[model samples]
Target: MIVCKFGGTSVADAAAISRVVEIITNKQSEQPVVIVSALGGATNLLLDIANKAAGGELLSALQLIEQLRDRHQREAQALLGGSTEAEELSLDISATFDELAHLAEAFRTLGYLTPRSLDAVAAIGELLSSQIVAAAFRHQGHPAVFVDARDVMRTNDFFTKAEPDTDEIRQLAQARLVPLVQQGKIPVMGGFVGATASRVTTTLGRGGSDYSASLIGAAIDATGIEIWTDVDGMLTADPRVIPAAQLIERISFDEAAELAAFGAKVLHPATIAPAVQRGIPVYVYNSRNPGGKGTMIAFDAPRLPVRAIAGKRATTMVKLRSSRMLLAPGFLRRVFEVFETHRTSVDVVTTSEVSVSVTLDDATNLASILQDLAAFGDVSVSPRAGLIAIVGAGISDGSLAIAQAIAALGPIPIHMASLSATGINFTLVIDDDQVIPAMQRLHATFFESAS
Candidate 1:
C-alpha cells in the first residue's frame, strides 16, 4: 500500500477535484490511502470566521460561514450531480455549518478565542473536504471509505500545534485502515486534523497536511508517500525568486529536510522525519501534470557540494555582549535558558569570546526575551534580517562549496554564518532585502553556471 496526499489547490473546486478523482482511479491498483487538505482558502476563511466571532462580530462570522457552506454544497452538487449521495452530503455540509454557527455564538458570548476553540474552527476545513471527496469517490463507483483522521491520528492536547502519538497512531491505523485496504477499499482521511486521547479536537498547525501524510505512511510502513501539489517538484531555487531555477529530479532525505527547514516551501520541515525513520521514499508530484517525473526524495541521491539554495526573510538577529562571558562555564546555558523561558526558538548561532548572536524566525516574545537576556549582557536586536542556505550531502566534505558561496556573495555584507553539525547545510545571515538577489546569484553560481 502507498499513501497519497493532495494539497489544497489540487482539490480546490469541482474541476480540481475531478482531476484528483482521476489520479486516484489510476492508482487504485496500488491500494492507495488518500489524504487531502482543505479546499483551497477554506482554512483561512474558517480562521477569519473564528476571529470575527471572538471579536464580537457574530453576524459577519455567520455570513462567512454561509458563504463557505454554499461553496462546499456547490462543489458537491457538481461532483455528485443530484444523486442520493449528493443529497446526503448536502445535509452533512449543512449540519457542519450549523455547528459552526453555534460555535460562533459561543465565541461571541465569551468575546475571546481560546486555542482549543480556535482549533475546533480550524479543523472544519479538512473535515468537510474529506467527507465530500469520499462521497464523490463512492458516487464514481469506487469503494472508498471515509475514515475520520481523529480516529487514527491520536495526538496530545497541544491545541493549535498538537503533536501526534505515533505509537497510538500506528496501532489505530493497523486496526482501522488495514482492513479496508485488504478488502480492496480505499481509505480517505483528512490531513492536519487529529484528536487528543480524550477525543478533543486538535490541529497540527499550518503546513501540517504534509506532516500528516508522512506520519500515516510511516504508521502503515507503506512503500512510498506521494505529495501532490501545484508545483512540478522541488527546484534548485524557488521559481518565484529565480525564474531559471531548475527542477531537482531527486534529492537525499537529509538534503530535502535542510531545504525545508531553511525556507523551501515545497515540503513542510517536519514532513521528512517520519519518512526518514521508516526508510520510506517520498515523492513530490504535480497533481495537474500526473505523468511528469517529479522529484524523488530518498537516501541514494548523488552527493554534490550544493544541491539547492533556500531563503526566508522576516528574521530578527539578537546579539548579546558581556565581558563576563570570556570563560564562564554556564554562561551559554543561561543565555539559552532565557530564550527557552520565553518559548522562542533560535535558528542560527554564532559566538565570540564576549558576545553571542542568534537569529529568530519568530519574534513574538522578543520584548520579554530581551528583558530576560539583559541579565547576561547588552541585548540588541536587528530586525528584518534574512537567511540563505545552501544544502547538499557533500557540503561537509571540503571547503570548496563554501568558497564558491562566499565568492558569489561578493559585496553583500553577511551578518553571520553557520555550518550545520552534519555539514550538509551552510547558512548565511544577511539583510532581508538581499535574500532574493543573493539566492539568484547563488543558484546561478551553483546550478546555472555548471549547466
Candidate 2:
C-alpha cells in the first residue's frame, strides 16, 4: 500500500478537491491511505476567530465563525451536489464551530489565552476539513473512512508541539489501521493534529502535517509515501527567489533533509526522518498538475555535484568575543545554556580562537539571548542576515563545487561558512539583499543542467 498526503492548496476549493479526488480515484486500486491538511487559509481564519473571542469580542468572533461555517457549507453544497452527506458534514462542521464559541466564552471569562487553549482552537480547521473531505469522497461513490487520528496516533503531553511516541504509535497502527487497509477501505485522516494518551488536543507545530504523514507511513511499513503539494517538486532553489530555479528530478534523503531543514518549501525537513529510517521512498508530486513526474527521494539515488540551493532570510547572527573562551571548560555548554534559557535554537555556528558566531532564526528573542550571553563576554548581534545551503550526497570532496559557488558570488561578502561533518551540505552566510542572487547564481552554476 502507498500513503498519499495532500497539502492545503490541493483542497483549497471545490475544483481543487475534485482534482484530489481524481488523483485518489486513479490510485484507489493500490488501496491508498489519504492524509489531508486544512483548506487554504482555514487555519488562519480559525486562529483569527479564536483571538477575537479571547479578546472579548464575542459578537465579532461569532460573525467570523459563521463566515467560516458558510465557506465550508457552500463548498460542500457546490461540490457534493447538496446531498445528505453534505448536509450531515455541514452539521458536524457547525458543531465544531459551536465548540469554538464555547471555548471563546471561557477565554473571555478567564481573560487570557493559554497555549493549551490556543492549540485546541487551532486544531479545529484540520478536524473540520478532514470530515468534509471524507464525506465528499463517500458522496462520490468511494468507500472512505474518516479516521480521527487522535484515536490511533498517541503523543506525549507537550501541548503545542507534541512529539510522537513511536512504539505506541506503531502498536496502535498495527492494531487499528492495518485492518481497514486489509479490508480495502480508504482511511482518510487529518494531518498535524494528534492527541495525548489523555485525549487532550495537541498539534505537531508548523509543517507538522508532513511529519504526520511520514510517521504514519513508517508505522504502517508502507511500500512508499507520496507528498502532494503546491510545487512541482523540490526545486534547485526557491522559485520565488530565483525564477530560473528548476525542479530536482531525484535527490538523496540526506540531501533532501538538508534542503528542507535549511528552507525548502516543498517538504518539512523533519518529514523525511521516519521514511529514511524505514528506507521508504517518498515521491513529491504536484497536486495541481498531477501528470508531472515530480522529485523522488530515496536512499540510493545517484549523487550529483549539487542537488539544490536553499536559503532562509531575516536571520540573526550573534558573535561572542572573549579571550576567556579559549580552551575554557564548559564554554560551549554555557553558550548553549543561554540559548536554552531563552528557548532559542542555534541554526549555524562558527568558532575561532577568541570569538564564536552563531546564527538563529528567532530574532525576536535576540535581546534575551544577548542578555544571557553577556555574563560570559561582549556580544554583538547582527540582524537581516541570510543563509544559503548547497546540499548533495557526494559533497565530501566538493572543492570544485565550492570554488564554482564562490566564483558565482563574485563580490558578495560571505560573512560565514561551514561544512557539515557528514559533508552533505556547505552553507554560506550573506546579506539578506544578496540571498536571491546567490541562490540563482549557485543554481545556474551547479543544478541548471536539466533546465
Candidate 3:
C-alpha cells in the first residue's frame, strides 16, 4: 500500500476534486490511503474568523462564516448533487460549521482566544473538507471511508503545534485504519488535524499537512509516500523568485531536509523525519499534471556540491555581546535557554569569543526574549532580515561551494553567515529585500551558468 496526500489546491472545488478522483482511480491498485488538506484558503479563512471574533468583530466574523458555509455547500452540491449523498454530506458540513459558529460566539463573548481555542477552530477546515472529499469519492463509486484523523493521529496537548505520538499513532492506525484497507476499502482522513490523548482537538502548525502525510506513511509502513501539490516538484530555487528555476528531478533525504529547514516551501521541515526513519521513499508530484516527472526523495540520490538555494524573509537577527562568553562553560546554554523558554526557533548562528549572533524564524515573543537575554549580555535586534541557504551534501566536503556562493552574491551586505553543524547547509543573513535577487544570482552561478 502507498500513502497519497493531496494538498489544498488538489481538492479545492468540484473540478479539483474530480481531478483527485482520476488520479486515485489510476492508483487504486496501490491500495492508496488518501489524505487531504482543507479546500484552497479554507484554513486561513477559518483562522481569520477566529481572530476577528476574538477581537470583538462578531458581526464581521459571522459574515465570513456564512461565506465559508456557502462555499463548502456549493462544493458539496457540485460534487454530490442529485444524490442522497448530497443531502447527508450537506447536513454534516452544516453541523460542523454550526459548531464553528458557536466557538466564534464563545470567543467573542470571552473577548479572547487561546492557542487551544484557536486550534479548535483551525481543525474545522480539514474536518469539513475531508468529509466532502470522502463523500465525493463514494459518489463516484469508490470504496472510500471517511476516517476522522483524530481517531488515529494521537498527539500531545501542545495545541496549535502539537507533536504526534508515533507509537500511539501506529497502534491506533493498525487497529482502526489497517482493517479498512484490508477490507478493500480506502481510508480517507484529513491531514494536519489530530487530537490529544484526551481527545481535545489540536492542530499542527501551518504547512503541517505535509508533515501529517509523513507521519501516517510511517505508521502504516507503506511502500512509498506521494505528496500531491500544485508544483511540478522541488526546484533549484523558488520559482516565484527565479522564474527560470529548473526542477530538481531527484534529491537525497538529507539535502531535501536541509532545504526544507532553510526555507524551501516544497516540504515542511518535519515532513522528512518519519519517512527517513522507516526508509520509505517520498515522491512530490503535481496533482494537476500527474504524468509529469516529479521529484523523488530517497537515500540513494547522488550527492552534489550544491543542489538548491533557499531563502526566507522576515528573519530577525539577535546578537548578544558579552565578555562572559570568553571560555565560558555554560554561557551559550544560558543564552539559548531564553529562546527555549520563549519557544522561538533559532535558525543560523555565528559566534565569537565575546559575541554570539543568531537568526530567528519566529519573533512572536521578541520583547520577552530580549528582556530575558538582558541577564546574559547586551541584546540587539535586527528585524526584517533575510536568510539565504545553500544546501547540498558536498558543501561540507570542502569550502569551494561556499566560496562560490559568496562570490555569487557580489556586493550584497551579509549581516552574518554560518555553516551549519551538519555541514550540509551554509546560511547567510542579509537585508530582506536582497533575498530574491541574491537567490537569483546564486541559482545562476550554480544551476544556470553550466547550462
TM-scores of the models, in the given order?
A: 0.98, 0.95, 0.98
Backbone Cα, N, C clashes tallied per candidate: 0, 0, 0
Residue range 1-451, candidate 2, lDDT tens digits: 8889999998898888888888999998887889899988888887787788778887888898888888888888877886877777878878887888788788777777876887788788788777778887888888888999887778887777788988898898888878998898888888888899999988887778899899999999989899999999888888888887787788889899999989998898789999999999999999989999999999877877687889889899889999999989888888898888777878889999888999998776888888888888999878989999988777667488878878889989999999888798989999988898888778778766554
| lDDT (tens digit, per residue) of candidate 1 on 254-305 | 9999999899988999999999999999999999999999999998898899
The candidate 3 region of ten consecutive residues with least summed lDDT is: 417-426
* Residue-wise C-alpha lDDT for candidate 3, range 1-451, written one tens digit per residue: 8999999999999999999988998998888999999999999999999999999999999999999999999999999987998998888888888888998899999999899999988988898888898898899999999999999899999989998999999999889888998898988999999999999998888988899999999999899999999999999999988998889999999889989988888899999999999999999999999999999999967788898999999999999999989998989999999989998888888999999999888899999999999888898999989999998888879878999999999999999988888788898999999999899999999999898
The regions of model 3 sitting more than 4 angstroms off are none
Best-fitting candidate, measured by lDDT? 1
Q: Give the TM-score of candidate 2.
A: 0.95
In model 1, what is the error at residue 251, expressed in angstroms? 0.4
lDDT of each: 0.94, 0.86, 0.92
Error of 2 at 226 (Å): 0.3
lDDT of 3 at 335: 91
